[model samples]
Target chain A: MVHSIDQYVDVVGAPVVEQLRRLGERLKDIRVVHVNSTREGGGVAEILYWMVPLMNDLGLKASWEVIHGDEGFFGVTKSIHNGLQGYPVQLKKKDWDHYEEINLKNREHLLPVLEEADIVVIHDPQPAALLQMIPNRRGIWIWRAHIDVSRPHHQVWKSLKQYVQDYDASIFSLTSFAQILPHEQFIIAPSIDPLSEKNMPLNKRYVNEIAKAYNLDRSRPLIVQISRFDRFKDPLGVIEAYRITRKVIPIQLVLAGGGATDDPEGKEILDEVYKAAGDDPDIHVLLLPPDAHRQINALQRLADIVIQKSIREGFGLTVTEGLWKGKPVIGGDVGGIRLQVISHYTGYLVNSPEGAAHRIRYLLHHRAKMREMGKTAKEFARENFLLTRQIREYLTLYLYLLKDRGRSVFV
Target chain B: MDMDTVPFYIKDCTLLIKMSGFSPAFDIRDLRERIAQCSPSVIYHHYFENLLAPTFDYPDFRNDFAVWVKRQLDDDVLAERLGMIEPYRFDSLEDLRTHTLDIIDERLSELHFITAVPPGHEFYFQEAITVVFETGHVMNNPGEMFKIMPQLTSSSIYYHFLEARRRTPDLTDDFSLWLENFGSEWEPLIRDLRSIDFIFYSLPELKEELLYIMQQYEVKE
Candidate 1:
């Protein structure tokens, strides 16, 4: 499943693909390593799945590495993750010690590759301590924070900042999500691979088969909110919206997501969602496996109006996936969701369940407006939120960091 | 047809935006104060970079400050005044900053209270690093450009047509500046390109307009 840069010529133009080749030419044979916590089941993993191959395709020597952690280690990292996203969690000295101990163990095998690489990008907090481990490394290190840390818990950030403070640079998904660090903070928004199983177009027969398997009635309209069962995603709020909308409009709601290996709080959140959705035939609360990408794609394609009711989000790739499938999305008015969903253009941004219900009913009633918004949404994703664009920016960043940091325009 | 004319080398750019290291502005008075002290790159980013940024709607106002004024402050009169100050019309970013502050200052004097937004709605200052590279496509003549124009990406169109004004000594697009070397025959097409009200159109729409003007000139020739 290796992807060539030329494969994207049809989606984006040849000039766009040619631009990537030229940028890739400038940094040919530079060893770039990306390290993260999980190898699958999250946005970071999905990005690396295509990024490593694409970077290699463009003639750069690129590789991806993952750090393995047990349940206790993951539990601590999950607390750190939640704490970074403005959640209040008490993390003691033992928690930080365990986090450092795991990274220290992984550093034994990774130091050889990491020390000699031209650039090493540490994704998220799981492997952030690796920078402090490699004291004499001969490369530019960048910390890519994929979550909102605008208002992080003081204790967590105070501890975590020590590990990331010495990096050459850092990247955040949004400006608001960035914290006041001592290095240059670049803002590069995350994008989805349109040709992946999660976002690629599916045939009507396959979509219908998925619908039939899930016992979803195709006659009525469906509102689907696909995300992990986390408190920040607000799965219960989506159920509340469904109940509010179901009173007048006959609709089915699907709240489906897969559990990432590093997430220890997902099971607890899923149990709460199940209890909230009790005795409701139309409300399908599915706990999918990590590899259920095609099924998730089918579910999104089956939906009339897609919803991503997140109280907080990294970049809301589910909202992008829904938009790519040509459906109007109703996202929460927070984080990256505000960037994607325009009130009257693509879809509505709601702050409460009542607001979500109102928009759902309005879009369902006006079919023509829904069609117009869907058309606009697809083209919007094509222009801005595609993986090709993200790759181009990353290549450009490499060139900037390697060549010259003072110049605003690089020729 | 002229042998002495230089070829047009097509180039494209992609923007990498970064925070300007300024604290977020919570109100109009704070915005004016920051505008007075912030760097020119920060001013240029808020005014010109919106065209390249990802947005769902065709915004009524062109710049981020005006949009914030309209949406957050809910003052269309002030928004209208701020949006009307075109960045490209100024000789320098310093002049643009002065003009921008004047409008805000005028409005401030007439207001009874300071206009402010809620915590989450504050305006954050940002700037961009534009990476420019040659696309390796060259046109020997305007006819060749006419043939290759539609095949170019929107970024290419932006680089040649809009962003050129910032870098070129003549403060005109690359196409028109290059056309000037071909003598008086290409004068009409150069005038058409220069006369385009490019501030209102999106990149795609702007490309269409460029193509339309080229097609009209092609038929005449």
Candidate 2:
């Protein structure tokens, strides 16, 4: 038999990792699989990538799979994403048929692997339709939704939920996202791995080198935020804030990020961002490749201040990444931003570019107080937002769902 | 038993005209209050007939007949809403049967409907609704509402007695004999109400039955 997840308590934390170890002692080698939309981008993908390995480290047979879709499929899914998030999307008959057809294709390739797994967790709208494919799966199929569906557009939500209802259980990121579906729902917010290369402390030399290479001046204060060039992330607004703060404390704004494989509208949004920043040398918009984690880490480290001025954010990982690096963050007051940036304590939650600019100027000018705030932010994240804590929450949910299946695997 | 169902009274207005012995070609179309001029019973009877009629004379009205019939007579608790609501709504009339069946395939969609709102609100309708906390709550049999709000004084026909006595020149000496004769006469038309295979041709006939119920409860002077 495999050893318990308690093997990870020292590496991660004692409370949850140790409990996982005890649970693992009893429920050893239980096969669990996760299926999600993208392999490289989005919070779900990033979390599952690290989570699967740690779960395996904890002695469970955990594996991960990513669903593949082409441009047409991605378009339909992006609309479905908006619909599920409460944006109005009028879906025609052909749209519904196209959604099922793509699911059928993915099923053709991925069906055999999913069916054999003990428990399959389908991630978001992309993999939700996989349930209709495996009618005879001997294991429990759980759906994991990580978007804000607190007030979803009815027509699309109802149509998409048609597929989700069949799963044995469902998991949501927040309480507001839970709908009146027949199955059970559990809340599991995402987390960042402290030990990962992206999060672990970086060398001062490397941070300085990246800043110099990116044409950044070390004499002036630095403000940075790393996110995709999408409307949801509000890259253009971030530029506006940098322009606003230039009047108070002259700091360079590094808008460093790139598009994911799943997003089709990235190029169009990128064009809009370029036009808005039009020939501004101080506004450094580095469209890095998808695998630019180390560059991102260095940018966060070099920054005297970090800001996530999003119009609407879906749990900004960049915010947590900044906080973990001991930088005071000024973020927008929406979605998971509220959860991350504790007002006047961890960082200030502002509404507009002017507001973000105001906070950025204040933080950049006050170096000593900013460092103290950064320390507070880091401790806040260490206590709450670590990957080990996230894994424990999930393990507990599994044991809870486990109670219905014949016998108690855990007390 | 009461001669009429509550839904039958609420819906059937046309047949009430014939029962009032008003001429069919009565050139009273110009009168503004003419439809309401007929007693509520006459309105109730016609509403039922139009609803139950297998074939409707007007094109806009054809889809209505089946739904109205199912409301009054279908024994299945979720009858009209199950099949009728999806088909007749604005978008689905394209391929008729196919489109209707596609929508009918859905077992549960959020039950979105209109409700009266308070005076100051600008919305023409409000989304005030609650999911039935109890199963079979919608299927209260024989036209009875499964639950009634005690604070509101308005009563229900299937659970509460009708209060008016029709001064029928043809009123029978005894109520039981009248009910038995009416039930027997209408047996051929009395849609097993349970095995409701066909829409009733006359929906307002229930108002005549309501007169039978009202005969039991005389309103005190």
Candidate 3:
């Protein structure tokens, strides 16, 4: 659903909307381009869905360009992603060669649009090397590394760092994930669109309908974990936690997530999740489509407890989504999840299935504590993790980078 | 890692004092006498001696090094110069001594280098060196010196404390004790750790991880 900045004025407040308008005035006529691996399925694409239009409405010539690549290209990028998140993945010489080869091919198709833009924001490792491939690129290029690189495998960081060190600046989700880059680094946590289809208020009737449609037993306290079926998301761990929690509390589990177009590892992980949930009637695994935003919203709203037990994460947008819906989230203690899920305040962070199950039982047993945490989670998300705050940071970065390079923001 | 031998020069004084507080095994008494004979104030004081255990004693090497120089050696100029020497900035005693000698080289010859090991206590020097250079004074040593030297090494205290934490992950009191005094590293890590990753580390494993970082950014006295 399309949303105007005015709609969020009441939700976020008049001050935030006014701030964006002022920033937009300084960024007027700026040709901003956001290039990433995919246009749908993933959080980056989902964010750009609203961010681009909002930027345009604010009077900037904002555009999003999706990069084209094949299975081999995505495979290499996925390995790079894993390596950046501190999982050791050895990229063979051909892996690096194949990555460069695909970007070079994409560069030919994207050069004209990329070079003409006043600012180009390349998201994650998939399109990081694009800057070097494009010729005479007349723009302030920023590499947005969306993975946790606090303890990156040395060889992998050595490879990725060379490609990104010369960019105008790098942006990470947290200060710990930041590297010793020559260029300045900024910490901008990813945000959820509070006014989007995935986050908008849904009626209890609609939520019940969606729950019935999914064959979920809402009578029992429902525990839902909504995320892509990725290994790093640790679908198995969530299942283990659910199984352990079910031993004491009569709770139902919903592992609902869709595969992103660019990610090739989804089916394998989905199958693993299926094997993990074998013959378990209490476990409801819903493989929703990319457009199942309302369903996701309803699931989050209906959930008694929301869990995102990712082993590694760039930033769990679903965690923010859960928090925004006033659900106390049990999230993995990694990446941007640490920034959102304040332990014992918003929700407890768990490391293992046993820990998750323990917290699950504690929260379920203590209804009042659960409700208090949920209330705090909602307010915390409102203050920090909303889309308007994200847009403000992006615009501010553009203005600062432009002014640093001797370009006048007023002009 | 580097070795050089220099001769001792005295300012016409034979008065010598023992440098105490190091492990009784280390020949610090002979070393201090050699140093004090040259100049009472120019004697080297180990950064560990002033540090209080269970509670970290802040490093005050400059003032302590100068007190000996001013009060004992009676050379105010040399005392002030020694006071100005920020030994805390150097990683090893060798580096600090070299830096100090360079500053006072025009005045003193080369004060004789004492190994700080007492007679018949050559084994303790080897043990101390092993702890300092090999295990970072936190691992594999069963000696009283190793147990007591964590505060002296600065980073070793954290390494040892983290090791204790790893051995008994459920011991909240031990973790709390470490957190109370040396929280600069643990608090940030704990605050930022994903809940799962926070529980993921066994105390020993966390120590090794912290030890790697401490090696890179060693806590100097």
Candidate 4:
């Protein structure tokens, strides 16, 4: 269990503070439960680790629970994840049996909690199957899909639909991600905490200390991309971009992040990145512990440039975090990344390492343009990517649900 | 508190205000049963016309429902607010357990046992069950609170999500498949909403004139 700390509280800002105070006054002692896969690694888990406690602090009884899944279950779920990301990977029928078996196992154990809570929220694909097996469960179940599903592969979509259809409702980060479900759907975009160590303004001393501790040169202009070392993240492509940009201006690159429990290919991708970075002194590949939030914050602050360059992305929280810290990020032009990295304004959305390298070179040479881009990027996040706005939408959604509950039927 | 009394109907105007902005005390439940009583579904029949069926069909659904709901608040300036407010305070989890005990102690000290359910009202709830006594009839309700699951208000994210599903989808399936699908999968939720010992009491259909409004829109099943 990740420690529920107040690390991300300040970025929630004054608007959320005022709104939550009012929300708490209206909602005293209301019980809320959030269930998602993994306590570390993924953005959903990271957000909830902070959000659940903050919700509780705002005068609601809120708690977080991590769902259990084994290697085979993850292997199956990863396929579904890939499939949802528009990848076609066929699996056997027993793969599904394993998925449901884990879900049923969890359902048997989670019955009491599910039955008792005022609201039982299930996150993502791994635990979504738990809904079908909920016997005598009473509370509302909302499926919070943090993925960008504008172009999901069909078979995986078809396979997951069985478990998904059982939910009271499903929420997508963007309107394009929603599918045909037998429940109410809402378009609630994901958010990053402006005050978290990953996004907050850190002291120059702290940034330098982390740099010194990691043997990173403070004088050298640093270009960093913080993301899990996964194939789709295109970490290798980022290395190529860094290498290309280094031909003219010798800059340091940091590719840092850890593997999610559900993502099996992360470690292999990490090893592959190391080979590409072999004997390159400027390239620093760090497999960071999941708790290294402040480390990332400092890196983004110190870095002259940041890049995502993922082939497929759900709303990239790292992109939001980088932009929030006033750094111009060049991210892949796909999925939720498109919502954040508005090409030329917030950051460049590139199709290739060549494209990414070209932007990096120009940004490095032109600090004034980079600074202007960073300001726009941070302002964009403040206007859109903050948690308070997401929470307000949720509160409004809740009110809509309650009022619609006992309304007279049209027919 | 006559059941038939139209307490606070706004005959001409419509108000879609938030509870926090308007009445801070009311739970802002769409279903009168949800916030009104512990077993508000006791008046399961009350929610039949009020809660079931497609919401998209009723353009005046929120306004019509608000007429009934606005009265359930006691914000003084607003509608009727039910549920006792004078309970113990447990501001946070650090003191929640201890505060719960204080509430228990206070309840013991101020014990006044009066039945919340009225005499013979059990028969009314009992009759409410048989409207969907057959499996076939219940499928028509789809994502409505009574048919979807127990304990969801229309305003809850869960309820809206279900509402989204109820909205028209360009489904690739046939009518035969949808009909043969008795949706026995949702039986438990329906069973929970309608009392287990529910009697077959049908609610009075109030908006027969507005019923045709639903045919204009095609909501997915």
Candidate 5:
């Protein structure tokens, strides 16, 4: 479903919505194009699903474009993705060539729209090579790196840096993820759509039905961690935490996620997670389809305590989603999780499975503190991690780049 | 009191923070060196622009340096000393930087070993690009503030009230400066605005404080 800026007025107040409209007016009719690898699945696609429509609603001419690739191309890009996340993967020259060749193939179809646009934002490494490909572009080009590339593999970063260095600007989700690029690098954290099926409020009946279908016992407390089955997400660690917690308290664990087309490593990780779960009835390792948003939403709503537990993360939108559903998140103390989960406030940040298990037990034992933290978590997500604030920052960046680069204040 | 014809053009701002290209500091000595070498904008952002950034609404300390000291280094005494340095009281950001380094130096002198955090907890230097724009809401008179106070976004509150201290010539809030044109009858409200200990309050808390003051004055009017 398409969303308008006005729909968010009830979630965020009228003043916030009105502020977006005013910012929108300043850049009315400016053509903005966003290019990424996949049109569905993953956080990038989910963000674009709401962002493009809302930008149009706010008066900017915005569009989203996706680059299609075969499995071999995706495999190569996945290696680059893993390597950028500090995983040791050697991407050869042929791998880099195949990556660019696929982008070059898509360049023919995308060049016209990309060249004439007022601003073109290339998301992640898949389409990052497109910048150097479109040499005659007449607009400000920005590369938005959504992953943690702070301690990337040297070979992969050196190759990727060449593709991104000439852009007018770059954007990272966190300051730590930024590299020593020659151009200006801005920090814009990703946010979730509160009105989307994934985060929108569901009726109690529907939530209960989802719970019943999943065979989750209503009597026992549930701990849900929803993320892609990647080693960085550490599904095995979540199970370990659950096992440790179950020894002290009876709780159910749901490790649910869907696969994206661009992520080639998910299947192997999923198999590993299933083996680690090992005949445990309470541990539900679900490989959900791409469109199972409401089911994910229901699972989060059913959770007494939400766990991300990612060893490495890119803003951890699942944590935001859980917090939006009024469940406190126990996230790993790495990457963007540190930004969202505050100890003794929203949720605790843990370094190990033992720490996570300890916090899970503590939260379950102290129901009142859990309720209070859940309340604070929801309001915290409302104030900081919603889509409106993200859009406002994007618009602000556009205004800053287009109008004046040196001025402290735009007006 | 006569109403001033000059309308207050209410504006709002959002900050787009970026890396200052400085290396992350893992220890107090490294932090002090970075503070001395980093640009003034970096100092200004950590000290002043932190309120508008995405963070906990009610942080224990007011600034990022102190928060890092308190949370990562686990040193309450140094955190308190660094937290007590008011950025607004300093004549310039350079002076603020100097005072910050002095506090760090004093703490370093007291410690037998350098206080260092673990790998992931290192302090990354950052700065922001603040984009300010007209909200298109104009206040015609001082009495209208009673109605407009609650409706203001936190960014609008920051732009007009807190950020105004640095921008205006007299180092006063935009509200107080605008109300000054209406004569001495609004002095009580101006005094009330001035009386706010803004250093400790977050944007939302500051907004609530402003709203409470406006509500009290509105009743009197």
Candidate 6:
């Protein structure tokens, strides 16, 4: 267990850490397996990279499992993703066949490990079918959907919900995103690892070196947005916002992101972003690799303001990371960004490029107000978004699920 | 010129505005008579059929009608401004029709002409006008309809049969299948009326089955 949960004492204080320890004691030695589609990139993988180790440190037997699929399988899953995020995509019979074929293959390799588990938490639509595939399953299965399914495409949702609605419980990032299912639904927002390399505090020399490597000038005001290059992230809208703000304030915008192995649409979106960026030197679009953690950390640290202008988001971990790093975030007023960006308190919630530009100019002009907002943002993250708080809730949920076998448990 | 001399342009063509629930007893006839005397080439209803048919139920009806008016009378910005008022927000369809007539009255007094085609001339105007009802809450726009109405129950029976299918696959015959097919087939027809054109309780010919479904599902207005 690399992350001992004790290391968070300095950031979140010893009392919260002790409380998490006390909650963890009730579920000691329980075999919990987290099944997801990828081990690298995306918020889910980055979260479990540290989360699994931390769970083991708390005296629980936690393991991470990855599902393997080819490009065809990934293509179908991407359609399901966009559909769940409210983009209408007509998924045909062949797409369903491809999705099931991949899951059926994965079920063969995963059955042995899954059969012996005390609890299995399936993340997102990619691995949702595994619960039905694993014959004579002994453990409680929880379907954790980490996307905004508030207004899903009716056809795509009909296909996906048939597999997940019968799970022991379903988890969503926000209550607004929860679907009407027969089983219990829990609204547990995604959290950030403050002690990880991507969010940990760094000194001046290393931060400056990473900034200079990316050709960023520290003297000028910088706006950074870190997310996967997905259409839902609205990277082009961020560029438009920068253009509107640049007319008055001389600022540089950095749209830095990496691709997840299981996401097939990243390259296409990256190409679109490049075409939209044109010859604007001030608009830096960096397509980094999956392991560029330190680089992302430095960019966020050196940034004057952080923007996560997503059109549809499922608890943006980038917003949490920026808040933890003491930078006010200007996020689109959608999805789970609404839960964090408190309008004028932490930052602003904007609807369009014009709204984002107005807020960007307002913050850059008022240095003292910006600093105060940043300070408030860090405290907000510390109170609500730390990993310890997330784990404590999970522990509580595990205990509750263990005690109640019925579909009545909810949070 | 004599003070009582009629302009030569008055003999160009006739302008007729047609609306239901309108009578000579109402004060609107004064405006109607003034419009008739103008000998305007355009008739209001027929001229705006293409515009009204696509926008009567659309939430952007006001803005779209304004654009159409602005294009037709490029120099009359006041007429364009009058076209943009959200008449649906009035107390009733009568109120909206009266407000429209008042605007036309103002335009006739200023421009000495009207900008509309005579009624009954449009090819599909009667069919388009037949679908619009004067009562019940207006959906007005597709965007607003989706926003206000519960999406789950809007077209699918899945939410209705949720409990029956809880334990196992609820294929209970071909009911859901039939409903899905029906929803897909009926989407285009209802979308035009509910989105671009008006839909009301008075559209009994097309709305009888819909009203039954709403009652069975307990869809309160």
The number of clashing residue pairs in model 3 is: 16
lDDT of 3 by residue, A1-411 (tens): 555687788787764575566667777999999999887898899988999999998889989988888998998898888788778899998999998888888898889989999999999988888989876989999888777787788888899887898888778776556777877666677888987889999988999898888788867899999999988899899899998888778899999998887888899999988998999888988899999899999999989999999888888899999988888889987777866777778888888999889989989988898898888778767756788778876876776677643211222
Q: Residue-wise lDDT of candidate 2 within A1-411, one digit each (tens)?
A: 112444445544443354445445444687888988788866777788788877887778898888777888889888888787667888887988888888888888787878887788998888788898888787888888887775679999889889999888777664445666776565566778776667776888988899889999999888888888777778888888888878766778888887788888788888888888889888888888877778888998988888888766666788888888888889987666766786666788888988998888777668788988888788767645777657755665565555543211214
In candidate 5, which residue ranges exceed 4 Å CA deviation? B1-4
Predicted candidate 4 versus true structure: per-residue lDDT over B61-164, tens digit per residue: 22222223332321221211111111112232224323323433443344354123221111111101111001111223233312322221222211222122
Task: Give the higher-TM-score candidate: 4 or 5.
Answer: 5
Kept native contacts, fraction for each prediction = 0.70, 0.00, 0.00, 0.00, 0.72, 0.00
In candidate 1, list every pair of residues with a backbone clash.
none
TM-score of 4: 0.63
Provide the TM-score of the second chain in candidate 1: 0.95
Predicted structure 1: clash tally: 0
DockQ of each: 0.71, 0.01, 0.01, 0.01, 0.71, 0.01
The per-model lDDT (C-alpha) reads 0.90, 0.60, 0.67, 0.60, 0.91, 0.67
The CAPRI category of model 2 is: incorrect
Candidate 6 CAPRI classification by DockQ? incorrect
- When only chain A is evaluated, what TM-score does every model earn? 0.99, 0.93, 0.96, 0.93, 0.99, 0.97
Q: Between 1 and 6, whose DockQ is larger?
A: 1
Chain B: TM-scores of all predictions: 0.95, 0.19, 0.30, 0.20, 0.96, 0.29
Q: Which ten residues in a row have the lowest lDDT in candidate 1 chain A?
A: A402-411
- The superposed Cα distance between candidate 1 and the true structure at residue B114, in angstroms, equals 2.0
Worst 10 residues of 2 chain A by lDDT: A402-411
- Worst 10-residue lDDT window for candidate 5 chain A reads A402-411
Each candidate's root-mean-square deviation in Å? 1.3, 22.5, 21.2, 23.2, 1.4, 22.8
Which lDDT value does model 5 have at B203?
84
**Candidate 3 regions with alpha-carbon error over 4 angstroms:** A405-411, B1-221
Per residue, candidate 1 scores C-alpha lDDT tens digits across A146-253 of 998888999999999999999999999988888898998999899988888898778999999999999999999999999989999999999999999999999999
lDDT of 1: 0.90
TM-scores, each model vs. reference? 0.98, 0.63, 0.65, 0.63, 0.98, 0.64
